[model samples]
Structures are given as C-alpha cells and as structure tokens.
Target chain A: MTPVLIVENLIKTYPAFRLGPVSFKVEAGSIMGFIGRNGAGKTTTLKSILNIAHPDSGSIRYFGQELPGNERAIKQRVGFAGGAVDYYPRKKIADMIAVTRSFYDNWDDEAYRKYMDIFSIDPQKSPRELSEGMKVKLNLVIALSHKAELLILDEPTSGLDPISREELLEIFTALKERGVAILFSTHITSDLDKCADHITYIKKGEIVASDTMESFITGHSIRGEGRNLEEIMLHYEKEDYREKFAE
Target chain B: MKNLLNKELRLSSHLLSYLFLFFSIMALIPGYPILVSAFFVCFGLFQTFQNGRETNDILYSALLPIDKKDVVKARYIFVCLIQIIAFILMAVLTALRMTFFANATPYANNAMMNSNPVFLAWTLLIFALFNTLFVGLFYKTAYKFGKPFIAFIVASMLTICVAEVSHHLPGLEFLNTSDRLPLQFMLMFFALVIFVFATIISCRIAQRNFDLLDL
Candidate 1:
C-alpha cells in the first residue's frame, strides 16, 4: 500500500517555539497516534501538514504530489478538524455543509449525511446553540463525510465524554477499515491505547519518537495509585524518557 | 469564476447581504445627499470579504478544490458586482432627479445611462480603474494585516478624496464651459490612464505578496 502522507525534514521556527526538519510517513489505512505534551509542537506539526503554516524548510507530499503553498488544491482529499473548527455562532449546519461540499470535488454526500444522522446533528440548528460535545461531533461529521483519504485531527476528543469518545473511536475504526489513514493528535494516552496503530511523540519542536504503537507504549508505562493522569504524563514527559531509550 | 462567485455569495449569507445591498442602494438618490450612502453600500462588498476572513473562515475555504489565485480573483469579482450595483442605483436616482427639472420632450435617463455615451464610457472607465486599484491593493493589504477596518478606511478615504476632486476640480472658472471642454477632457483622459495603470500595478503587487503571505 502507498503511503498517504510523506513528510520530509519539515521545519518551522518562531521566537517562542520551533518545529522540525522532521520526517515520517503514514501508510494508507493505518491510524497514527500523534502524542505530545500540551506545548510539544503537535499542533504546529499538524498545521504544517495542512499548509496553514508555511514551513521554513524541507518537504511534504500527500498522495505523491509535492504540496504547494496553495491550500485550495492540496486540501480537497484531506478533511481536517481541530480547535480550528470555529464556526460562526449563527451559521446553520446545513449551510456550512453545502458550502463545504461545494469546495471538495471528492466529497461523499452520502457519508456526510450518514454521519449527520449518527451524530444526531440537526441541519437546521445554529451551531451556537450546540454544546461543545455536539459541536465537536458536528465537526467530525463534516470531516468523516468528505470521504477523505487522509484525516488530520488535532485533539479531536478535547471536550468529548467517554460515551461520545468511544463512539467516535468506533467510527474511526470503521474508516480505517475502509482504507483511510488517520493522524490522531492528542495528549490523552488512553485514547491512543484504543485506536492507534503507530505513535509519534513530539517534544520541544522536534519529533522525539516515531514508531509503531506496540513499540511506543512498550517503551513506557503509567503506574499510579489514584494519581491524576495528567500528573503521570507530566512526570515521565518531563524526564525525557526518549533520551534514556537512546542510551 | 461563476462557481466561486456563487459560493462566495452563499458564504456571505444569502439573502442578508442582498437585503443590505437593497437598502444601501435605496439610500443613493443623489439630490438629497443620498449619494453619500454609496460609501456604506460599498461596505457590503467589504463586509463579505471580512466575513470570509473571520477566525477559521480561511481554514474552510482553504480546503476547497479551487486555486488560491481564483479565490482572490473571486473577491475582486465580488467587489465589481457590488460596485456595479451601487452605481446603477445611484445613476437611476440621478436620472429621476434630472427628469424633475427637464423639458416635456422625452430623453433617455442621461445620468443613469449617461446622455453622452462618452461621459458614461469615460466615467465607467475611470471608476473601474479606480476601483480595481483600490481592491487589488486593499485586498492584499487586508490579507497582510488582516485588518479590514483599517484597510477599508484607507481605501475609502483615498477613493472618495480622489473621486471628489476629479468630479469638481477639472474645470476652471476663467474659461467658458464650451471652450474648456477640451481641457477638461484632457484632464479626465490623463486621470483615466493613470487609474488603469495603477490598477494593473496593484494586482501585480497583490499576486507577489500572497505568494509570501505568512499564512
């Protein structure tokens, strides 16, 4: 199977943060877990992939074509969801869907409709009235409906509850089975445990770990007697475990 | 281009902007300071541009299958659409008012259609030239600063200032209206040429700036 995404030595530097000449590839139909601490450059890396942030150097290729600076052409086969899914409070879901579908030549109207049904999204309802969960669900519905070969989600489960999260994961599995590759970016390791095939760990603007999920989780573990998950993640994350692995 | 225009219209909220356009145009009856409303009506097209740039607005549009150049081109077209509409409304009012003072002999609406096709032609030529320069420069500037209000203010100030001067300043009191027509024509002709040249240059600058846009 061909790789759906191939990023080579990408770099983005700013006064406060920096990102790579990082390189990696995601095979079609595999779900790659993109994990990092809160400020670990996960979003920056994803933004680079989307062509939302221009890279300082290196290359990115999607479906074997070099990504141009133009978002219109590079983005059609890709469906993206992030904190970036901010919709106008008054915008009706139907209008957004129709407008969005008009832009993507490969969009699947049937799939989108199915997700709209599954998510219980009322097309007539204004997005402002929806709960955070409902909004996230709607964003997913939009992304899933597009028949995207490559899905790049930045913290897709941010505000989702367990039930909603599980349901979303189930849908992700279904899509993976249909040959869609997914880059699931999240800090929640629990989510990765369920859905990830490969994991890439980013730290301080560089990709510190890029390996299969089976190998990544094997490299570390969280053990605690009722400690907060965030605390444990911070504990190991602060120690630079990847350096130990290198040793 | 049509697809882009149609989609942009929808993005600006169908029926809403059109309503705004309707009311704005209605305010352009030239006799009673109504022509002043043309500026606010021009705001309709600019607002549409603004709506597209709101928080994640670019993210969604960036996902479309069209070219970015076409996307920018669509914005230029929308500006034209609004400008044409605003002019039509103002022209009609100007014609209607002119009729109030004219003879019983029937005459086609001169102000709206330009009784002298030369003036209409020249007016259209100059206005288009002015507008194209304004849009090309201001659109890219908007992208750079992402501040529509400032860009709007600057473009509005420049266009109104220039247009006002051209409208009132080209004729001298020392010369007869008939004799000075040639001199006025020359002034208008030079203005038209400069405006066209400026617009072309502005569009070129816009193209290059977008290539290096931080986003």
Candidate 2:
C-alpha cells in the first residue's frame, strides 16, 4: 500500500538553528508518534511538510504527490492542528467554523456537529472564552470534520488533562481504524506509550530513532524487559549529549 | 480566493467601520481636503501594518488550503476596498459642500475645488503611491512594520510638499485657474495612468514576496 506521507532529506535553516536532512514515512492506517523535546525541530518539520515553512532542500510527498506543487490538493486531504487554536480571537466559534468550512469542498456538517456535541463546544463562545484544552478540541473538531485522510498535530496533548488526553487517544485509534493516518508531535511520552504504533524520535534537529514502537522499546530494553517510551527517549537524549560534549 | 478575501474583510471589518466613521466626521471640517486625504492614506497604511502584526491571523491563514499568492491577492483587495469606500465618502461630502454650503464662510473661498478634477486625480495618485510603497515594503519583509510605516509617511509628506511648492510657482499658477481646464484634465489623465501602473506593480511585488515568505 502507498504510504500516506513520505518526507526525505528535509532541511530548513534559521539564523540560530538548522533542521535536518531528515527522512521518515507514515504508512496508511497507522499512528506515527513524532516525539521530540522542545525546540527539537518537530514543529519546523511539520510546517515544512505543509509548506508553512518553506524547506531549504527536501522532497515531501503527501498521498504520493510532491508538496507546494500539489500543496492545495494535498492540504485538502491533510488536516493540521497546531498546539492551540490561533484563529481570530474576537470572532465567534460559529463564525470561525463558517469561514474555515467555506475553504474545503469536502466539509461535512454532520461530522462537525458530531464533534461539537462530543467536545461540548458552544458555537457562540469567542476563542478567548475557551480554555486551552477547549481550544485544542476546537482545532480537532475543525480538522476531523473536513474528512481529512491525514492528520498532523503539534503538541496536541500538551495542555490537556489526563482524561481529555485519554479521550483524544481513543479518537486517534478510531481514526486509524477508519484507515486515516496520523503524525502528531508531542513531548508527552506516556501518550505514545499507550497508543503509538510507530515512533520517530528527533533530538536537536536530527532523527535519533524511527521504527515500530515495539521494536524501539525492545531494542532499548533493560535485560529481557522492554523499557517505556520515556526511558528510551531519555537514554538516547543523554547519549547524544555525551557524544556531542565528548567531541 | 473568494473565501480568503471574505476572511480578510471579516477580520478587518471592525477597523474599517471605525475608519469610515472617522472619515465622515473629518469630511465635515471644510477646508482640509489635503489633511483628509493624508489621514485616509495613513489610516490605510496603519490598518495593513496592524493586521500584519497579528501573528495569529498569519498562522491561521497559513493553515488554509490556499496558495501564498492568493493570500497576498486577498489582502490587496481588502486595501483597495477600503480606499474605494474612503474616496466615495469624500466625494459625496465634497458634493454636499458644493451644493448646500456654497455661500458659507468655509465653503465660499475653497481654492481646492477651483480645480476639482485635478485635486481628485492628485488624491488618487497619492493613494496609489502610498499603496505601492507600503504594500511593496511590507510584503518584502512580511513581518517588520515600524520601518515601512515610517518610510511611507515620509514619502507621502514629501509628495505633498512638492505639490504645494509647485502650486505656488508662477509657471504653475495656471493649474489652479478655471481658464486652464484643459491642462487640469490632461494632468488628471496622466495621474490616473501613473495610479494604475503603481497599483499593478505593487500587487506584482506583493505576490512575488509573499510566495517566498516562510509564514
């Protein structure tokens, strides 16, 4: 089966930092947990895939088409949710949704209404009135309602309570069952431990590891027992730091 | 593109309404067409810069399934709409003053109206120049606002000063007289041509710059 997303040799530069030369792929019907520490280029990489941040060099293929060249078409099938809803703060939730809905030809009103009911989001509330978790939920509702086959989220669970996080994990599982691919960046290792089928770990702008989550855990296991995602991440990060300083 | 334009207008609707009200009040103050024009130009510049500073709007727009060029086009269209509204208001006010208050103290000696078509054409050219400089510089940088804002103000003031100086020169004195209607009409035509070119060039520069912008 064709992968839902393919990124190869993606590189982006800023005055203070540089992102790889990184490569990864997310197969259809899988949850790919993009795990990284703060400023580890996760957001940069995600943005590059969408051409929100133009890459210095790389090729990104979404649903088998080159990005930017196929940006409008690719984006139509890919839904993105940042850490928070950065929509017009003064506009009502209904108004914001209406504006977003107009841009997508595949927008589903029933799906939007379903998520709104599940999330308990009031259509009349302004963005400022919603809590951070609610804001993330709002973004999710918008993304999921558009019939996107691929969902890319940045720090999606960072501000959520444990129960809300669990609910979102359930939603991701349901999406995967429906053959939708997901690639979400997060520092929350436990969320990945519970739900991620694949893990791609990035450290300071480089991919330290990318493999099946079970393989990743067993490879870094202590004795015969597999380590949790957090312990594995800490081990790799420390190793990278020691090697850098030793150089 | 239509959806993007609609979003831009919705985002700036409140500010646009405030500007309309302010211009309406200013229009009643008889002898300051130049001041009114300058304020209209500056307000347009200010609104664009202020909107650019709203990073949330930029980020949100980036997520939409549209090309960066479409985003630039939507913004340019928004600026044009605001200008059209301001100019129509000013024209209506001028007509009112010319009709109902022609003999009133402030309206009786209005020198600006002696060459009405020329003054109106000059106003359009000033707006076009202002849009060109402001939009071109803003899109080139995309994020910085202070320098572009200051540069536009300086350029506009210089243009006004040069026009005022020329109006007082003996060789150009006929420009303000009724006997030189044909000359005024020619100047108006020339200004309109420059206005169209400046607007086209500004949009082209904006589209190019925006396509390369990272966010």
Candidate 3:
C-alpha cells in the first residue's frame, strides 16, 4: 500500500545550521513517532515536509502526489497543528474555528462538536483561558473536524500531565484504528511506547534509525522485548554525550 | 485568496483600525495641513499588521492550504481597501470645501495647505510612500515591524512638509487655490499613477521577500 507521506533526501540550510538529507515514510492506519533532541532539526524537517519552510532540494509527496503543484488540494485532505500555530489570545475559540473552517470544504460540524465535548473545550473562551493540555486538545479537535486523512502534529503531548498524555495517546490509537495516518514529533518516548507502531529517530539532523518499535529495540542489541523506547533513546543519547566529551 | 482576506479581517484586524477610519474627516478643518488625515488612516492600518505579528498570523496562514504568496497578496488588498475607503471620505470632504464651504473666511484666509485636488494627490502619494517603505520593508523579515514603521514615519513627515511648503513657494501658489482646476486634476492624475505604480512594485517586492522567508 502507498504510504500517506514520503519525504526523500530533503535538505534545508541556514547560516549556522543545516537540516537533512532526512527521509521518512508514514503509512496509513499507522502512527509514526519522530523522536529527536532539541535543535536536532525535528521542527525544520516537519516544516519542510509541509513546505512551511522551503527546501533547497528534495521530493515530498502525499497520497502518491507531489506537494508542489497539488498543495491546496492535497492539504485539503491533511491537517497540521502544533507550536507553529497560535490562537489570537483575545479571540474566542469559536471565532478561531470559524476562520479555520472557512478554509476546508470537508469540515464536519458534528465531528467538531463531538471532539469539543470530549476535549472539554469551551468555544466561548479564548486560548489564554485554556491550559497547555487543553490547547493541544483544541488543536486535535480542529484537525479531526476536517476529517483529515493525515495529521501532522508537533509536540502535542509536551507540557501535559501524565493522565492527559495518556488520554491523547488513546486518541491517536483511536484515529489509527479509523485508518488516519499520524506523524507526531516529540522527545517523550514513553508516549511512543504506548501508541507508536513505527519509530524514526533523528540525531544531529540525521535519521539514526527507522523501523517498527519492537524491531528497533531488539535490533539495537538491547536484548529483550520487554525493554522500552526510553531505554533505547537513553542508550543512544549517552553515546552522543561520550562523543561530545571526547571532542 | 478570499478566504485569506476574510481571515485577516476577522482575526488579525484590530477594532481601533476600523474606528480610525473616521480620521479622514480631519480634511474639513481650516488652517491645517489636512494631509495628516491620510497619515492617521495609514497608522490605523498599521495596527492590523501589529495584531498579525502578535497572533502569529503568518505561521497560522502558512499552515493553511494556500500558497505563501497569497498570504502577502491578501494583506496588500486589505491595506488598499482601508486606504481607498479613507480616500473616498477625504474626497467628499474636499468637495464640500469646494462647494458649500468655498466662501468660508476661515479657508479663504488660511495660511496652511487648502483642501483641493492637490491635497488629494498628496494624500495618495503619502499612501504610496507608506506602501513602498513600510509594507515592502516589512516582508523582508515577516516578523519585525518597528524599524520599517519608523522609516515610513520619517518619509511621510517629509512628504507632508513638502506638500505644505509647496503652497508657500513663489510659483507653486496655485496648488492651494480651488480655481486651478485643470492643473489640479493633472497633479491628482499623476499622483494616482504614482500610487498605483508604487503599490504594485511594493506588492511584488513584498511577495518575493516573503517567499524567500523561512516562516
């Protein structure tokens, strides 16, 4: 089956930093967890995939169609939410939704209401009135309302309580069951252990590994199925610190 | 593009920007430069950009399905709409001064720039300069506005001074009189051309700069 998203040898450069020749794939009915330390070019890679940050050279396709010429049409079927998007703190949530809804033709008002209820977001309140977890939930509500086939979320579980993180993980699992492809980036590997079918690990703007979660743990010679993502991340990151100390 | 404009108006625009449209009425005052009315209108539009930056409008819009160029285009259109609205009001006030208030002693003995087509032309020129300096420079970073706005203030104050000083110059006295209809229309036409041409150039530059921007 064709993957929901394919990014090939993507590269973007800055005066002091560079991201890529990074590549990854996200298949339908699956959740791909993108893990990287801060400033490891995770956000840049995500933005490049969305073309929010222009790439110097690469190929990005969604549903087997190139993103360049078919941006609006393809994006109509995709939803992105995270740090890059912020509400007008003074504007009501309903007002923000109205503006966002105007851009998508497939918006489902009933689905929006259902998510709002599940998330406990009050449309009358502004973003300033919500907690960090509530804000993430609100972002999820907007994404789900449009019946998005693919959801690209950045750090949705960051700054959330453990229970809230579990609830959000459940939502990702439910969405995957419904065949919605998800690509989320975060440093919290525990959340991935619960929901991610596949894991893509990045360090210093390079993909160190990309595979099924179980295989990733065993393939690293960690020697047990019971071993988890956090242990694996720690095992690799420790080597990074050793290399830095040696340098 | 329409959806983008609607988003700007509904989300990014500040209420004070709309209320400031009333500043165009300043044209009715005698012994005043009157061109300052146009400056206040542009200042009102400045608030919209300010609100956009505070709310992360650029990143939010980039998240949508539209091209980045369309985002820049929508803002240009919004600025033009506000400017055109103010221009229309100022034009009406100028007409009132030329007709019913033409014989009023305050205007007749006024030492300042009078309300005439020349004044309208200068107003358009001010708008043009603002678009060229303020809006064009803004897209270079798409984040900072204070420096670009300061440049616009300096340029506009000079423009207003020049317009006021023209009436005091020996051969340029006709610019303040209502009787020089043919010349005033010509000046207005020339200023209109500058307004359109400068704005188009500014938009093109803004689009290119914004396209090069990362966010």
Q: Arrange candidates by DockQ, highest first: which order?
A: 3, 2, 1
**Candidate 1 vs candidate 2: which has greater lDDT?**
2
Off by over 4 Å in 2: A222-226, A239-247, B12-14, B21-28, B41-45, B96-105, B108-115, B177-179
What is candidate 1's lDDT per residue for B1-215, written digit by digit as tens?
Answer: 67777666766433444555565344323223232354555555556655666634555555556665566666656665665675566556544534563332322221221122123223344345435544565555445433534554566556544543443454523121223455655655665565456555656666565545545
Residues A1-247, candidate 3: write the lDDT tens digits: 9999999898888899888888889999999999988888889998888887899998999999999999988888898778434678889999999999999899999999999998889999999888877887888888889889999989888878888888889989999999999999999988898999998999888888888877887887555423677777776665566788899
- For model 3 the local lDDT of residue A236 reads 66
User: Candidate 3: which stretches are off by over 4 Å?
Assistant: A83-85, A222-226, A239-247
- For candidate 2 chain B, the 10 contiguous residues with the lowest summed lDDT are B107-116
Choose the strongest candidate by TM-score.
Answer: 3
Q: How well does candidate 2 score on lDDT at residue B11?
A: 62
Per-prediction tally of clashes = 3, 0, 0
Q: List the residue pairs that clash in candidate 2.
A: none
Question: Which structure is stronger by lDDT: 1 or 3?
Answer: 3
